[model samples]
Every structure is written in C-alpha cells, then in structure tokens.
Target: MHKRKISIYCYLVSAAFIIGLLSISMFISYSKDPTSSAKDDNQLEYVTPEEVGYSSEKLNEA
Candidate 1:
C-alpha cells in the first residue's frame, strides 16, 4: 500500500511538470508581436493597384 501511494504521487508530479511546460510554450507562442507576422513592408499600406503602377483593369482580367 505504501509503494502504491508513492507510484501515484510520482505520476501526479510528472503530469504537473508536463502541463507546466505546455502552458509556458503556449504563452510564449501567443506573446509575439502581431505586426511581425506580415511578410511585406508595404502590407499595411492601403493603396490601390493603379496608385502602385499596376492596372486595376488588368488585375480584374485574371
């Protein structure tokens, strides 16, 4: 009976450790800068195709 209690405590401690590591990993993954996700520097610009030297009509044809 004493050995069974020890085994149960070991399992509980191991599970708690794994859960703590997973929680930290998730927090780090979610704490990144939102703007850093954009691939292009001009991604935040609100210009039309014609303003950037591209024809809107040509884009519509595709």
Candidate 2:
C-alpha cells in the first residue's frame, strides 16, 4: 500500500511537470508574437466583375 501511494504521487508530479513545461513554452512563443495566433486584420483586395472576364453590362441587362 505504501508503494502504491508513492507511485501515485510520482505520476501526479510527472504530469504536473509536463503540463508546466508546455505552458511555459506556449507563453514564450505567444509573447514573442502575440498576433501570430490571431486572425488577420488586413483587408482583402476588391476585384471587379470585368476583371474576371464577367461583363457588368450583361449582368445589368439580366
């Protein structure tokens, strides 16, 4: 029973250590480039129908 308790404690400590390491790495990476994980705020270029070979005049007639 004593050995089993020690084993459980070891497992818990190992899991905690792994989690801490992962958290630290994640924090460092995010701190370096916080915007890297965020969605792009840049506006997309607007294209006209004529630019893609679609006639605006034909669409207007329809």
lDDT of 2 by residue, 1-62 (tens): 99999999999999999999999999897775755676557857779999989999999999
Cα RMSD of all models vs. native, in order, equals: 4.9, 5.3
- Relative to the unseen true structure, what is the C-alpha lDDT of residue 44 in candidate 2, on a scale of 0 to 100? 79
Assess each prediction's global lDDT (C-alpha) against the native. 0.89, 0.89
Per-residue lDDT tens digits for candidate 1, residues 1-62, read 99999999999999999999999999988885666855766557689998889998889999
Clashing pairs in 1: none
Off by over 4 Å in 1: 33-43, 46-62
TM-score of 1: 0.54
What TM-score would each prediction reach against the true structure?
0.54, 0.51
Candidate 2 segments exceeding 4 Å error:
33-62
Per-model tally of clashing residue pairs: 0, 0
TM-score of 2: 0.51
Considering summed lDDT, which 10 consecutive residues are worst modelled in model 1? Answer: 34-43
